[model samples]
Target: MNAGAVGSDDPGPLVLGPMLRYIGETDATVWVETSRPGVVTVHVDGREWAAPTFAVKGHHYALVVVDALEPGGAWDYAVHIDGALVWPEPDSAFPPPRIATMDRERPTRLLFGSCRTTVPHDREGHRTNGVDALRTLALALARGEEEWPDLVAFLGDQVYADDTSQAMREFIAARRDIDKPPGEEIKDYEEYAHLYQLAWGDEANRWLLSTVPSCMIFDDHDIRDDWNTSWTWHEEINRTSWWHERLMGGLSSYWVYQHIGNLSPSQLADDEIYARVLEAASGASGADRVEGSELDLTEAVFDLARRTDRHPEVYRWSYRRDLGDSRLVVVDSRAARVLEPQHRSMLDPDEMRWLDEQLSGDVEHLLIGTSLPFLLPPGLHDLEAIDEALAMGKHGRIAAQGAEKARQSIDLEHWAAFNDGFVEVFEMVMQVARGERGRAPSSVVFLSGDVHNSYVAEVVDAKARHGASSRIVQAVCSPIRNPMPRMVRVMMSSFARGLVRPMRFVAEHSKHVPEPAYPWAVTDGPWFDNCLAELTVQGRDLSIVWRGGEIRDGDDAHPVLTTVASVRLPGPSGQPPGALGWASGSSAGSVS
Candidate 1:
């Protein structure tokens, strides 16, 4: 258990929680938040830093940037929060301890996922218990039971202030007016603040965040469902005074919660507010002392992120990483969208230009972190397209809205709905896949999670699985916590299998996904129930493995879920698996 997060008696054993991400670049910047104010440090290999964290809106968070790192080298880290030392759980799905960095030197392994609601375990009524994917991985490292991943990319829905749990609801009641039905969502800063606490303050997850150098991109739930998709959407939302406060609170808290740690020294040097944040953190009071409460500073910061795009080169949320031979482009899909009707785009012109530039295959492997999958399951994509097209006309509008509500009822908001924006991102990725605009890297992969299930799908070109014109495969690890209703599982898969392609074909407004000749297909199997996917890139070969928890046949009446699937990628360099599913790394690296 992490020392700081748990009170005495220790709250059982403080297990790690969702979004256990690792993001490594030439300069490794590990970002996370804690339950209370104290020093959070990462001991990389051997060296350590008393990373600075700030308090805002009742939560404590930090982005510990470890600079001067060598690419392709592996290093282990231990997390220290306040005075207590904490590590990952033994069965943690996240490979812990040491990670091999990527660059020109070694292979890059990226494990990513998202869309986790902070719900109590079915029996525990607390954050722990059940098969916690991240905790399993974290504990693996703590016990030296698994391989450390080079990086972990977290896509979307980090905090769901809107779809809060009962514990969260009670916490909200202690603070403010939950009397009104701002209907099904969170309303103000007070609510937003406590929601974040419930989301990240869990003991186990806090330890994971403190150690792994993580990268993140936000999605709708970070603020609310269907945020900033279109002008109509925004208008419909703004109809309530509660909506404005919610947006203000959500976005404001995000500045402190997720975005603060993503900045580099160079980036912060140029960013006014971040620069202020760095300066203040370097001093005694930090942001904590700068204002009456961290919330005051956070409120202003969120407004800055909201307005940064209108004033480019100042507040860009998109980031780039040079991790050995691999390059990671972490984009801010939510804030950067051009949702206005006049010119709707997945990313605004400037942000799009930045992402477009990073799509080249310059590195050994290219990883694009867009909260929403650039390509959704074929059936679901088509369904969303059908609904979108229907929404354009008179009767279509009613039908589309109703269908959208249905999709919402089942939690299906991905690239398919906003066909225009979806196509733009698809084109960008395909262009990279084709290496038309520039040098195409050995592998171009999209790491995403928002869907409640986990699976790996390799994109194969119509003619060849591994060739100049091969299709792209998508690997998804979702609901690091099982948030889907059991009944909806089969239905979600059926929809994905049935409707995606046709919808994508019709929704090809931006010219990315080729019609009839679209260049990617799914090759891996899908597995839901709190799982993660690990991809290892050694030279030109990429091996992807999907890992989850399992339940033993005997032992106790209730079988504990343990590692279930280990779908190995077809590569000479992929690891050799032992009987029960643990795989040993092959020489996938160009390094000695």
Candidate 2:
């Protein structure tokens, strides 16, 4: 890893990315990693944009901001490192990477899913996890067999920092004692970088990322399972000798690799760390320098990470994007938690306020992208609310201790587990639906992934008491690769169906539990397939499709994408005419 090799004579190799991110009608950002510090350039439309590389630890990286493009234009692009072509490697089979800008006249299609694990794309890996749905989509896009999405939002768990694969474990064993503290789990920044490289380095997926814009938010597995589940859990983890390093490493690397790319150019410009790095790299700062070359941001990143961890309020990971008449608000559910025992909330006060403002409904469709489902199956939601009550000392100390153990053991820490916060957010949704926030949208949809299964739930207002103008629904897709075990799937199925009546009765009668403001029921599926979902919004029409990869004729190298479920959500007036055959009625019913 040469740190400061100068010029094109010793140009470094492109390692990862040319990942197209944060695209608008006329501008976009391209991120990359390189073997050494060198300028990264993007060539498109007979023009080139270049940015100097910045160093972090021993790693060199750059984000080239390409601007002044035609609105709604599609331009093929190439990457150059120090004036040498490195992208579209010789003899490449796929089409050259292209930048497709947003077009308001066309429908907005978003491809989204979460909880993917990195493994070999072979028979054994497919058997152990499942075929990679994202990879299948990539293959389709590369072959021009499917339409390209305007954006892809990875809801969460893009990497499992705690659950290392055999390859990652081998990488760790070669560097450190895997049997020691932190074990095979990632311990520091360098390891996280390697983990990301492994996750995104696959050729098919890499090409997809290079051509499509993406937005992402981290879930529990991005750091550890059940991360920040509770204050007790937090205190328990902080006591470990390796927790500090793990925390800082996960957060800082996330900032560099994932978070910054999610921001628009204006947002990036306002970021303090981004500003500092650009200033130092451009030699605009008067600070003492070793030749005043590319700035090293390792220490600065760690400082920001430390501050973010200690005071989560100081930074907001949530962001909003308005695409034509639709608004997409991606929320940071995991990190923005208010973990105080007496007043537990999935989001702190500030984050909640921010979300309230972002939930306005002037658009035809309002999409809320949360890593955790805002609406769980009714029975499971009740069980989690009860568990939260017990854990909050509603039944005294002994019961609280048992509830805490149960919560962590079963991963019962979704929005329902934070009962008060759940209700507050629900009220906000209700307000939006009722046209209180603004002109109510045709639909207020919550897009989420997690819980290892996919489903669609719709709010049921039996008497039309709220007079809601928008169709409120929850659409969830999970595990772009990883599949749930048989037993866990059975348990979840029971929760989704068998326990509904009993749990609802218990919840309604319990003194500690508060009645929900509105009843909702799962209207479609509890599908356990490893799948990705697509949401298309064309004017007042909205539809969602879940797709999974199916290996055909034993061709492990290429899996065909098969539709798992398709639903056409009704608008304010009613179901759209000529709806798809599989589109289910949004009638009020008992919970799943």
Candidate 3:
């Protein structure tokens, strides 16, 4: 192959990332968006891999899989478009492209967070709650101080396609009629593309994304708030005139942008929708530059997305990865839901079976990343279960209607609401912990967000048959930038403190619920701070730290990381820490 010529003055390709994705022992994927078509190349320590860029509805993207790297190897890399250097922006202070492949012996340190809104990170941004923890960490890495996490798992709500920011509204107003159908929120593929650009476009975060491998799962906000919360909710949304257009746009954009990067080359080969794109690209093969339509792969992808939305059983969005001695299972708690009125489930039967299989495996540590918390506070759990039960006609039809109304009003949809699905996954987790299927892992950790408050909770399995060996923990960090309203915060604090006993009592006597096999409570926090959570897993010990962004001396755009709370857990050989009872709840004040 001829080495592409480099020109110092030529404009480079890359509008967004050299974002790392799915780094394996032998290969890794780098995703990028470029202005004008050309061959997009990622160079690792002088070794180069290139892929032709393709267009979808006018936006250009390329996914270059850098293969044949040694395990545990680290390499500083660069990006070029049609032979012109692009990345490590001119006089850039941020670090350049560098990747460290997965190594079995190394401890997996990961940073996870969700629910960040797109807004300028200035003084106004800070005062209004846009002090981004992810951006702060990026700057710290840029300054050559902190080491990078092996991966950053964005749990959900990466972009609020349903909620419009002021900047986004301005853009919409300038280009189209804000008074039109679909209004201020995103309308179609063009708007969704722009929303992603807003979310990941900022330079500091962009650089962080370029270097650290990222995995994402979408929540309701990626399409619309309360998406598929219930069968009734789905029907209600379907009635809207623009809902079809919105769904098509959101899912298609998610496919091209977020979902593709989550899969490995091997996994991508199995994806029919993505497979067609590669086929299209290879058919009209180009070495360097190519016209947009030569490889456009939108229509086919959009058609599949529509079918998947309507008939979810046809496709599976959840995926699992084995990172050496540990395993990461990212669940699809949103789109793969079973939304039948009488049999609502967090996941469809097939998806649940898949999760059950993925749950059991021999590993030192098992991490389950879900957009919604698998285990909420006992009070919240019971409340959601009650709502779901009532909606299912545990009471009369009139009462069921009232329950459905309440469910929609309060957003009462989570794993707890779908008791059967929750119990199934929970049982599988416990079975694995007890070594029923394999050697019990040291810990089974659920890393989740979406509550807008951060906390740590440990399962209190009163029914353990042989003194449960594995430590089951729920760690949540939320709203890397967005802050809850004061009223909502107060309400959440009250829910955390005063309702567990009453709700549990209701569950005990209610005909709807079979008494829970295990109960849990908030042991560390109900801290309402816009923050991120990090976990370090090595051998039999697991430690978690929550960090919030703290702006100093009015430097809102450059907030520093401050520890909110932390805890450590030992292996199954040791006794797990005793749960601090519900009375120990610290909801009176925010942690930060």
Candidate 4:
């Protein structure tokens, strides 16, 4: 990325990201949404590229593809929507600004994080949560202050219609005439359109979206918590007639607001309706439909994708990308599940089979991006597993009725909640780990966020796997902005390690199924903050660093390395704490 982005006084409102998607078999598709019909030009390395605009339902979209780019090179692109520069000028209104995009020769840097709340940008700036960390990085890129990255892989919860901010509320109040009450959320097509405007209105974040090549999927908050998890979860939500409208609103909006841009050409084909928009993008003049093609075929695709788990193979929220030798597979943890019965799987079998095909033996690093961590704190993992079994009619009363009510209250449906899905993914990874069919990539790394905390772990030989010596690392980065409550941190620590041991005991004695010997250990930390993880492979060694933004003692600021970790294939065995160095979320002096 050149970082020579020209700033404009008139920064436009066509928000760009949670900038995500991959350069794969399909052309490199850049996704963005505009308020009304207009022309948005995406410039790669200062050259104009293919801009396809379309409308769906009612929203506007732009997908610009920089055709035939090199696999290992870094390409910086600037965006102009209808002649107005989209990213903000240096000294962004948000303060201390952002230091984004670092230039590199190869596919070394991966900037990523997830679960950001779309709270109204506190204009008063108080309770505003001020500047965005990722956006700060973006400012750096726009000003050529930092190097450009190879890619940005956003995990999930890119937008939160379910959890709106004061700003969003205000937006909804004016545009909507709902009689449900003050906090009554958006329910149908029209209301969802308003929600999307609230989520993507910030000029700075929107500009960053325009420039950075991003890849994204959804989490619960993208719609509502625990969406499509089980029969019980589904029943509770469906009990109210408005529930279906609420869900349809969420998913339908998701298709409009986020999912449309993430599609590769092949994925678009699977998206029966979106395929038409892609086809129309090539027409002599109607390609503008990409921006306003909303409320049409795109809306229909969302409805079908939402209402039925029956056509699991038709539209997938999952995608794959190849950057040099590394491969990233982003999964749709929410939509691709077999959540009817508690015993059912999280990933439908067909999706699982497709993933099996995608994970191959060629890459140096294989990153599996899922909003929910594959390996939760063994304690939480087991707890959800236990609840899943109990809910499946294992115990009499609890299994029969109490479990259903309990399921609704607590979040019992992550990978662990749906143990079947959990087991399936675990086994599939192990198969890759054991070098069974796929290319047996060196490190089968699981990149996740949504635990409200962050840590790194490597899966080793469990009693269940017996003698298995594969390196499956789980790297988690969360809340590019939202941090968890401090009180819970203490409890998360006390019950973390010990929780897994008791889980092993319960599984072995009560369930009578042999449990995997607990072999994984946390090497980095449960650090919590608004952070963006930068992943790089300098040479033979791979380094994943978590960066945090900060203000200095003098109140000026800069972005620096908070946590640094490196993984060499067959990494060092007898290592100590500082061996894999560490520093505060901020290193030393502020850049200002």
Best by TM-score: 2
Q: Please report how far candidate 1 places residue 57 from its true position, in Å.
A: 4.9
Q: Please give, for residues 1-592, the per-residue lDDT of candidate 3 as tens digits.
A: 0111111133245666778988888889999877666788888887899887777777788998889999999999888888888876767766667888999888888889899998888887777765788888888888877867888999999999878888788777877888987889999998887788788878788889989999999999999998998888888899989999999999999888889899999888789876755765576454422354446667767887889998887888788877887889999999999888777789888888888889885789889999999889888888889888889988889988998898888888989888888888888888877778788888888999998988888877522643556778888988788889778888888876787889889989997876767666677777777777788885788877777767778777677777766767666655544443222222122543
Superposed model 1: Cα runs more than 4 Å off: 1-3, 6-27, 30-65, 69-104, 121-130, 181-185, 281-296, 305-314, 341-343, 394-413, 458-471, 498-519, 551-592
The better candidate by lDDT, 2 or 3, is: 2
lDDT of 4 at 71: 40
Per model, state how many residue pairs clash. Answer: 49, 0, 0, 48
Better of 1 and 4 by lDDT: 4
Sort by TM-score, top down from the best: 2, 3, 4, 1
Candidate 3 global CA lDDT score: 0.81
**Best-to-worst lDDT order:** 2, 3, 4, 1
Q: Give the whole-model CA lDDT for all candidates, comma-separated.
A: 0.59, 0.85, 0.81, 0.62
TM-score of each: 0.77, 0.95, 0.94, 0.82
Best by lDDT: 2
| TM-score of model 1 (CA atoms) | 0.77
What are the runs in model 3 whose C-alpha is more than 4 Å off? 1-12, 280-293, 461-467, 577-589
Report each candidate's C-alpha RMSD, comma-separated, in the order given.
7.2, 4.2, 4.1, 5.7
lDDT of 4 at 140: 65
Tens-digit lDDT string for candidate 1 (1-592): 3433422334322222222333444555555555555566767777886655565565556656566777656676666766466555444444455434445555666677787667653445322423556655665555566776666667888778677777777666666667775654677666666666576665445555655556777788888877766556667777866776677677666665566556665775676666655666566354336443232255556667456534533567778766676777888777766655334566667777777787776566777777776666655656555554554432446765775565555544456656566677767766776667666665566778877766655554322433343235566777776545545667666666766655665657523323423544554445556755677875766666655443344222222324435544432223221111134322111011
lDDT of model number 1: 0.59
Residue 272 lDDT (model 4): 64
Model 4 earns a TM-score of 0.82
